[model samples]
Target: MKDKKIERPIFPKKAIITAGMPYGNKDLHFGHVGGVFVHADTFARFLRDRIGNENVIFVSGTDCYGSPISASYLKLVEEGKYEGSIEEYVREYHEKQKEVLEKYEMSMNLYAASALDRAGEIHKGVSEEIFNKLYDNGYLAKASSPQFYDPDFKVFLNGRQVVGKCPIEGCSSDKGYADECDLGHQYMPDELIDPKSILSGKTPELRKVTNWYFKLEEYNNTLAERVDYLRANSNLRKNLLNTIEESLKPPVIFVKRKQLEGITDLEEKLPKHRTIDEPKKPSITFVFESLEDRDIARGVFDEVGVRFRTGKTLVPFRLSGNVEWGIPVPDKEELKALTFWVWPESLWAPISFTKTYLETIGKNPDQWTEWWHSEDSKVYQFIGEDNVYFYGIAEMAMFMALEGIKAGDKIDWDKINLPHLIANSHLLFMNKKASSSGAVKPPMARELLEYYTPEQLRMHFLSLGLSKGSVSFMPQVFMEEKDKQGPDTVLKDGNLLTNVFNRLVRSCFYTAQKHFNGTIPVGEISDSIMEESKEAILTYERHMYNHEFHSLIYVLDSYIRNMNKYWVNNMRVADTSDDNALRKQVLIDAFHAVRTVTTLIHPIAPKSCEKVREYLNVNENLWNWEYIFEPVYKFIVDQTMHKLKFLEPRVDFFEKHQSQISF
Candidate 1:
C-alpha cells in the first residue's frame, strides 16, 4: 500500500495537530473546547512527549469565509464597522480560545492562519489554482441559474442566510438554515414557507445568477471508496462512517429542466419568468419537464454514457463563480465562464498565525511538507460532528487533488491514500442536564479547568471517552462510575485531579518521613508496589496508544488509589522495631509507586506532574517511561528512611453535593 508505514521518522518525526475550524458567527461554548482544542492539545502534548519537543509541531486556525462570513460582513457594513471585521472577528475568537487554553496550560508549536500572515495571496492563489484546474478539465459551467436574489437588498441571499416558517409537521419555531429541524427532520430550502432573507426582510426574487461548484458529485465513487476505506480500516467512528456513506452516495438529482413554450434561440430575449430557461443554441438538447424529472433524464444519460453531438464535452460541473461573497476568481472573467472552479477550503486564522511563526523562526516551508505530504505522517483531525462535511470530505478532496490524486474517479479504491487518521468528538452537553429545546449540549473543558486541576479534567474526559462515539457531560455519572469496586475510592465529582495531587504529596511525604524516623530501612521497593507500579505504567502506554483514553483514566485512578491503599494497609500493621530498614522500605516502595503514577499522568496535567518531579528532586526528564521505572527502583534501594507527612485524602463533600444537585 502507498500509505504503508515508513521507517519511523528519524528527524522531525512527523506529527500534525489540527483543531477544527471554528465559524466566527457565534460565541464558542464548552463542547467546542472539549471536542477540538482540548483534544488537539492532548495529542500535541502526547506527541511532544513521545518525541522530543523539536520534532513535534501543532497547527490550528479559524475559518473566515463563505456565506456565513459574507452575511456577517454585510451586517457589519450596515452598522458601519463591525466591532470587528470578519477577519478580525475570527481572530478575536481564536485569541480568546488561546487565552482560555493557556490558562489551562496548553502549549502548541504553531498557530497558523490569516492573522499570522496576510493569507490573501495564499487563499486567492489556491482557490484560483483549483478553479483553473477544474476549468481546464471542463468541470465548470456558465449557465444562468435562478438563485434567491434579494432585490431590496441588492444582493443574493445565499441559501444559508435565509430564514422562514418552521417545516416540521405542526412545529412553530423558525426554519433557518437547513442543517436540521428541531423535530430532527432534515429539510430543504423549498420546505421553508414565507422564506425571507435575514438581511433585507424582503421576499427573495428568483433571479438568474452564475456561480461555481467543485463537482463534488463527480467524486461520488472516490468518496464512497474513501468511506469504505475508513469503514474497512475503522478510521472513523461507526456513526461517522455511516454519515459519510449516506451523504457521499451519488446525489440523486431528480429535478429536470422545464420545456419552454414559444421560445428558443440566442437572438430572442430570454424568458421573463425567473424559474424557466430556453437553450440559446439548441438541436440535440431536449428540455425535460422539471429539475426532478431532468435528474431522471440525467440518470438515463449517465447509464448510457451519453456523448455530446456538438463535440463539447459534458464535463461534470465542480467549481462555481457564485459572486455573493468569497475569494474572487483570479483568472480573466471571460475564461472563468468557460471553467469549473471553486474557492479553496478556508482554515481558521490561528493556524495561519502558526504558519507565520514557523516561517519567521527560520523554519523552511518544506518543514510542513513532511507532515502534509508524507504517508507516515498519520494526520488526525479532531473536530465536532457538525463539521464533518468540510473537514472530513471537502478538505480531503482538496488534499487528494493537490497530491495529484483524482478524487471521485475510479482507479483503485483501495489504493487511494488519504489521511490515515480522523478523530471526531460529538457535542459534550453542559452538566448532566438535558434541555427541552434540543439545543446542543455545551462542553465542560473551560468550566472544569477553572475549579479542578487540569489532570483531573483530562482523566475525567479520557475515562468518559473510552473508545465510545458519543460522550456525555454528566459529570456526576463520570465521577461515580468505576471499573473496580472499593469502599474507600479516590475519584470524586468526575473531578479526580485533587485526588492525584494528594497522592503525590503523600508519596513524597511517606518516602521522606521513613528515612528521618529510622523505621524499616529503605533498601528496595517491595515486590508488591513494584509490580503494581509496572502495571500502572504499562496500562497507560497501552490505552493512550490505542486512543482508549477513557479506559486509561480508570486504570490510572485505580493505580493511585491502590498505591495509597498499599501504604495504609501495610504501614499500620508493620513491625517497625524488628527490621527498621525493611519497615521504611515499604514507605519508600509506596513513594516509588506514586512517582511512577504521577509521571504517567503528566501528559494530562504537566504542571501538577512538574510539582511532583520538583519535590522528589528528580530531574523533569526522568518522567519519560524509559527512565521512570529504573529511577524508582534505584531510589528505593538508595534511601535509608526519609521525613514526610501522609495527609488523609480530602474529599470536598460540600462541592460534590452541589455539583450532584446542579444537574
Candidate 2:
C-alpha cells in the first residue's frame, strides 16, 4: 500500500550514448550544443544515476576527415589565413572543440577524433572491418555514378566544391551540392541543376566515377517495415519518422499531366510503371519497380521534352569516393585509390570510440561486441533532425546489412542489435536556420559561456521542446531591446535553481546549524511530503526513460517552487509562535525535499548539485538510485557523529553570471 503509484519505466542494464560528432572544420556553434549535445549529455548523465555510472558509456568526437573539412582547409590556406597542413588544421579545431566541451562539463567517456590520436588508429581499423563485413555479406555493390568535374580548375570536385539547385520537387534548401543538399536530400550528381565549381567560378561537368555503394534501394521494404516497428514501440520524434517514411517510398518521378498528352502509347514508351493519378493535382506520380527502371524512364522523359522532378526515395548510399583527405577504404578488385566517404565512416565512428575506450581500460577491444550487440546493453544515438536521412535511413539499413546479408535475406530484427535514434528538431537562431557563414551569424558555443554560466545555458537548452518542433533561441543580449518586453526566455529555467531551489537548501542548512548543532534531526518525513517526493521521482524516471527532457524541466519547476512555498509558509508560523516542535518537524520535511531536489537535478546541473552534496557532507552514494526513495539520514553511515559543513552568510550554490549582475 505504501508503494502505490504509477509504475516506473525500466532502464537498460548497460547503455552506450553517442552525441552527433561535430565537424573539425569549425568549433561547435550554439545549435550544435543547444540542439544536440546538451540533450545527449543530459540523457547520458541520467542513465549513470538511474543505472550505475559504470554501466553507462557516453562518447562523441570531431569529424576530422570530410569533404567539408577539406574545402574549408583549402580556402583558408589559399587566402594566407592558415600556415599549417590539413591534419594540423583539423587537429587545431579538434582541440578547441574538446576544450569547449570540457568547459560545458560534457561527461564523455572519450572524445576522440577520427584522424588523430590512438582513437584515430582504432577508427581506421573499425572502418575497414565494417566495409569488409558488408562486402563479405554481399551487401556492397560497384556502381558508376556521375561526379562533378571542373575543367578550368582541372580537378575532380568533392561534394562541397559544387553548388547547384536541388532537382527534388518542392525542396526549400538554401544550397545544393554535388550529391546532396544542405537539408540532407540525396540525388545523383547529374541531377543537380546548373552546377558551379567553387574552385573556378565556372560551370562543372558530370563525369562517370566508379565507387563502392551500399544497395540501400534494395532495403526500402525492410526499412519501411522497421519504421512501422519504431512507430508502434518507440518514443520517436514525429519529424524523424516522417522524414524516414518519405525516403522509403518506391522510386518515382513527378510529371505534369499536360506533358503526358503528347506521347503516343505512353504506357509502352515508359519503363514498367504504375501511374498514380491525382485528379485534383497538376502532376501525376509514376512509381517504378526499381531505381534502374526510374533512370531509364528519365531518359525517355528527356527525349519527349517533358520536364520532371524526382521525389525523395532511397538512393544507393555511396561508401567510397575519390577525396584525398578521408579514411582509407579497403581496396576492392580494381578500385584502389578510393577513400571512405565521410558519411559512411562517421556512422561507425562511435563503435571505434567504444573499442578505443575499452582498450584504454585494459579490456579487450573485442569486448565492444557485448556492449553494442548484446540484448542487455542498448545504444542511444542522439542526432539533429538534419541527419534523419543518414542516421535514420542510410545508417540503419547499413547496420542491418552488416549482419551477414545475402542477395535476398529477410533480417530477423529481433536478433540484431540496433541503436535507438534520438533525433531532435532544429534549434533555430532567431527563427532562422543556423549557419556560420550565412546572414545572421550565431554565437559560438564558447561565446555564450562568456555571457552566461554553463549551468544556466544547460538548463535553458533542456527546457526547449525540440522533440516536438523547431524552437527559436532568442537571447535578448543579441537582439534589439525593443523586440522583447519581459524578462528573457533564456533565464526562466535557470531562475528556478538560482532563486527557488537555492533558497530552500540554504534555509535547511542554516536552521539545522542554529537548532540542531549542524546535524539533521532524525525523524520521519510527513505522509504528504513522502507522496509528493514519490510522485516527482517516479515522473522524472519515466521522462528520462523516454528522453523527454523539456517535460522533466517542468516537473522540477513545479516540485521545487512548491517545496519552497511549503517551507516558507510553515517555518514562518513556527518561528513566530516559538514552537520548537513544529520548527524541527518542518526542518525535517524541508531537508527531505532538499535531498530529493538535489539528486533529481544532478544530471542537468551537476556542479551546483555537487555543491549541495558537499555542504550536506555526504559521499558519492547520495546520487545513486539504489536508495532513491529513502530519507537522507539512511545514507549517513554513522548519523550521530555526522555534521554538515558550516555555511557562510549569503552563500549561493547556483550562481548568476557577472554580466547579469549590477554593481
Candidate 3:
C-alpha cells in the first residue's frame, strides 16, 4: 500500500499583512518596490483569493514624522528650493508615494500616513495608549543619558542629524547615526566614533538628557527563547534569525592590545569580566556576564584612555527623544516636553492604519482587535533584512510586554500570536547596493514603467529570489555599457508570461473557434492532466506558505510550459488524423489546464488573467479558489448555451509594450 499523503498547509481564518513604510522625505526608489512591496502585495493578493477577500487586511503607510523628513525639509528651505512649510513638504512626497504605489497596482486596502489627516489623529491616540500601557506595566523608565548636542548651533540633534562610524563589532555599514547604525544595531549615543553634527559640520558634545526608554535588556532571556522557538517551529528567514542571535550575545568590548598595555592591574580596577588574550591577535576582548558589568568596565576603560568598540547586543530601547518634529510624548513626572522617538512610534503605525481603514468602512475602530488580537488571526510583517533587529526583536518584546508579560516571564507564543516576519535580502542595483545618499544612485520605482508594462515588471521582481539572497536588478535599458541590440536579461522570466503562456491561451481560444463553434466542448479530462494540475497546485501552495516566492515562480514556469507543450503535441495529432473525438478530448484537457493556470497566476499578473476571463465569457467567480479544481464549464450557468466571446484576428491576451516591437 502507498503511504498516506501529507495534509495541505493551513491558513489563518483572519490575517493582517503589512509592507514596511517608506519615509515621506523622497519618492520611492526601486528597492522599495522590487525588494519589499511587490512581494508583499503578491502574497496579500493570494491571501485574498485563498481565503475570503473580506478576511485579509493589507496595509502600509508613509513614515511621516522621522528626522530624515525634517532634515530634508530644512535643507530644501535653506537652499531656496521651496517656500512651503514642513507639513506641506511631507504631504507633497506622501501624495507622490501614493501615486507610485497605484502605478505599480499594489493592492493595499489602505495606504495611510502617520501625520496626515484622519490617520494622523488616530496614530496619535494609538501612540499615547501604547505609552501609557508600557508605563503602567513597568516596562518604561526615565533614564538621564547623554545625547548628542551641537554647541555650534546651540541645539540638540536628532539621530539622523548626527553622522559617525558605527562602533559595533564587525559592522560594515556605510552610515551610522547617534544610537543605532544603518544596519540596525543598538548602542549608546556615546559609543559612536568620530561624531559630527550634520547641522553645524562640527564635532558635537554629549549632554545629559532625560528620555523614556523601554527596558529591552530586561527581556534578554525571553527574546532568546522566542528566537529559539522561531528557529525550531516557524518559517522565519535564516539571515534574520542570525541577526537576532547576534544581538542576543552577551555584552563584550574589544580593545587594541597596545591601548590596554598602558593600564597596569586593569582587572583589579574594572568590574568582573572574562578576558580573552590571544598572542596572534592585535585586539584583546573583555566579555561580561551582564550589561551592568559591561558599562562599569567601559567607564574604567574611559578613565585609562583605553579605546574600545562594543559588540552587538540589546540595549535600552529608547521610546522618546527631544526632537520637536515628532509626536509629543506624554508628560510623565520629570520626563516632560519630550517626543516619541520615530522608530518606536512607526512600529505601531500599521495598527493605526488598520483602525483608520475600518472607520472609513463605517465599522467600529476597536473592531481591529478581531484581526490583531485573536488566536485565529495572524499578522505578517514584510520588511528588509536591515530591519530584523527592530521588527524581530524589539517589536516582539514590546508586544509581549503589552500583553502583561513581565520582563523575565516566559511568553506563550500561541497566546500572544506575535507577528510573523518575512524579511527579504537586499535588492542590489548594477551589482552594488544603491541608496539615495550613496554614490551609486538608484532609479526611482516609477522610472521603470517607461520601459515595460507594470505586469512585466511585477513578474520579474517576484522571480528575483530575494527571499534567499541579494539579487541585482540589471535592466538592459539602464546599463551604462551595453550593446544597442542585445538580449535583455531582465525580460527572461517575464517572457514565460508574455510569449509562452500568452501563446497557450490564444491556442485554446482559436482552436475552440475553428472546430467547436467558439464553445467550450464538454468531455472528460484525462487522469494524467488532472494529477499534474494537482501536483502543481500542492507545490505552489507549499512554497507560498513558506514564503519561498522565487521557488513558487519556478513551479509556475514548469507547469505553464508543460501545459503549452501538451496543447501543441496533442492538437497536431487530432488535426492530422481527422478524429473529432480526439480533438474534443484535447480541447477539454487543455481548457482545464488553462483555467487552472489562469487562477494560479491571477495574483501575480491580474490584469492579463482578467482579460483571459473576459474572452472565456466567464463571470468573476472564475477566480474563486473554491472552484479552482473544477472545470471551466462548472462556472457556466448553462453549459450547452455557453459560447465564448469572439476572438479577433491577431489578438494577444498577454501583450508586450508597443515600444518592444521593432516593426
Candidate 4:
C-alpha cells in the first residue's frame, strides 16, 4: 500500500509579526537577538514569501516609559556618567538599539520607540484610544491600592526604584521590583517581602494610590476558552500553555500552620474559601472561587496577624501608574495625574508602530485595522518564556475586553483575530541564564559580529531549538583558554552553510563555467532528484509552519549534503569519460538542486542567498512561493540563448569572517 501524502499548513492571507520590545534604557543584549528577534524576523520573511510582501508587517520598538529607564537614568546622573536629560538618555539608547538590530540583519519594517519622534506621538494617541475603549466597554476599574513610598526620600517609588524579595509562592527570581519580578511574576506592592527603596537605601512604606486597572479576573473563563482553542488547533509551546494555565487557576493564599493555630476563628472571619491542611506541609492553603474573595480573605488574614503569601493567579491588570516619564494618562473625571504603565502601553506600541509605518509609506494610517482586526489577518508575537503571562494572558484578555466581549459572552474567534504567541525558552550563556541586571553579564548583540558573520550567527541562533528548551550559546571567542582551541559548538550548524553548502554551490557554478561556457547546461533533471527536492521542500514548509525551526535546519543539512555527494559521485564518471551529454546531464541536475536549496534557505541567510540569486541572474520572483517548487529551467526566459554570469575564482556565496576562518 502507498503512504498517504502529508498536507501543507495553511497560512493567513495577511500577517503582522512583532518581536517583544526591548527596554530603551540600554543597547540590546544577545538574548534579545538570539532568543526572540531572529526568530520573529525569519518568520516574517517566510510569510512575505508564502503570502505577499504587501500583506505582511513586521514591527517592534523600544519600551521607553518604564520606571526601569527612569531609575537607570537617575543612577547615571548621580554617578556623573551621563549629563543628558532622561529623554535624551532613552533616545540615545533607542538609536543605538536600532543600529545594533540592523547590524544583526533584523529586517523590521519600523523599529520605532514609544518615547521618540513621531512614533511617540502616535503611541500616546494609541494609548488613549485603547484606554477609552476599555473604559467604554466597562472593562476598566479605578482601584485604590498601596504603592511603595520611601519616607526618607519623600517620594513614591515605582518599579525598579524599589527592590525586594519576591513574595510570590515558589518563585525563585533573584530580583523583585515594586510590582513584578525579574522573572515576570506579578504581585501586589504590599505583598513584596523586605522592600527597600533604591533612592534612599531604606525600607519603604505602603501609601494609598489610585490607578486604573483592567478587570482581568473577569475574563478568566474567556481566556480559558481561548487557551483551549489554541491547544487544540495551534502549535503553541507546551511550557507557554502550562504557564498560562497556572495563571488561570483559582486564587490561593498560603499561611504557615502555626499562624492558622493562633487564629482559631479565621474560618468564621474570612470570606468563603476551602482550607487544604496537609500534615506533611508547613503551610495551610486557602483557595477562593474569585479574586475578590481572595483579596477579602487576605485582608482578614492581615488583620488576624497571619503571615501569608499569594499564589500565581489572575489579578487586576494595572494600566496606569504615577511614573512621570511615561505617556500621560488621559484625564478621566477626578482620575488625574497618572501615566500609562509600561507593560500595558508597550502591549499596544506595535499598533502605533504599524500606523507610523503605514503613514510613512504614503498609505492610510487606518489601514492598520485591516491587518489587526480582520478575520483574514493574523498576528504572530515572538516573545521570551518569562513573558508568556503578560503576552499570552493579560494581553489577550485586554484585547477581547476592549471589543466588548464580556466574561460569559460567546466568543467568535474568527472575528476577534487575537494574537498567536510564539514563546521561546531562555538562551543561556555558558549554561547559565544571563541578563544585564543579573550576576553573569550577557554579551551585547553587536559584540558578536566581531568574531562571526551575521549570517553565521543567524544560522546558529535559528538552530538552537529554543522553542523546546533552554539552549546555551557557547562562542569560543568568549571561552577560557582551555576551551578555545577546538571547534565552537555554536558554529556547527553555521558550518552547514559556510562550508558544506558553500562548496556545493561553488562546485556547480565553477563546473558550469569550466565545461558549458558559463551557461546552465540544458537537459532533463532526473526523477530521483526531483522527488528528493520535493520531499525536502514539503518537509521544510511543514516545519516552518509549525515553528519547528531546528527540525527545518536538519532537513536542509541532510538535503544539501546529499546533493553535494550526488554531484561528486556523478561528476567523476563524466570527467573521466569526457562525455559531453553526461556532463550536461550532471550540470542540469546539480544546478536544479542548487536553485531549490538556495530558495529554501533564503529566509534564514537572506544576504548570502540573494548573492546566489545575483550570480544566477534571477529576479526577486525567484523567492515567491508560487514558483518555489518549479525547476530552474522554468525560470529561464530563453533556454537556448540564456547566458549565466561568470563565476570568479574563490568567490563564496556564503563566507565566514576573516577571524573565524583562522579558528
* Every candidate's lDDT: 0.52, 0.89, 0.89, 0.88
**CA displacement after TM-score superposition, residue 48 of candidate 2 (Å):** 0.9
Candidate 1, residues 168-195, lDDT tens digits: the string is 3334344444223332223333435567
Better of 2 and 4 by TM-score: 2
Candidate 3, residues 1-663, lDDT tens digits: the string is 024486788999999999999998989999999999999999999998888899999999999997788888888899999899888888998999999999988999999989989999999999999999999878988898999999988988888889999999789997889998888878899889999999889999999998999999988888888888889888788788888888998899999898966577899987878988999998999999998899999999898888899998889899998778889998999678888999999999999999999999999999988899898898999999999988988898898889888877756765768899999999999889999988989999999888888788888898999988899988888876644357777787788989999998888888899999999999889988988898888889899998888898899999999988988898899999988898999889999988998888898888898899998988878888777778888778787779999999889888787778678
What TM-score would you give candidate 2 relative to the actual structure?
A: 0.98
User: Candidate 4 clashing pairs?
Assistant: none
Model 1 lowest lDDT segment of ten: 307-316
Q: Please, what are the lDDT tens digits per residue for candidate 2 over residues 259-345?
A: 888677767888999999989999999999999999999988988889899999888999999899998889888889899999999
> Model 3, residue 266: what's the lDDT?
90
lDDT score, candidate 3: 0.89
Error of 2 at 371 (Å): 0.8
Cα lDDT tens digits, model 4, 279-325, are: 99999899999888998988898887778899988889999999889
Instruction: Arrange candidates by lDDT, descending.
Output: 2, 3, 4, 1
lDDT of 4 at 521: 77
Enumerate clash totals for all models, in the order shown.
Answer: 66, 0, 0, 0
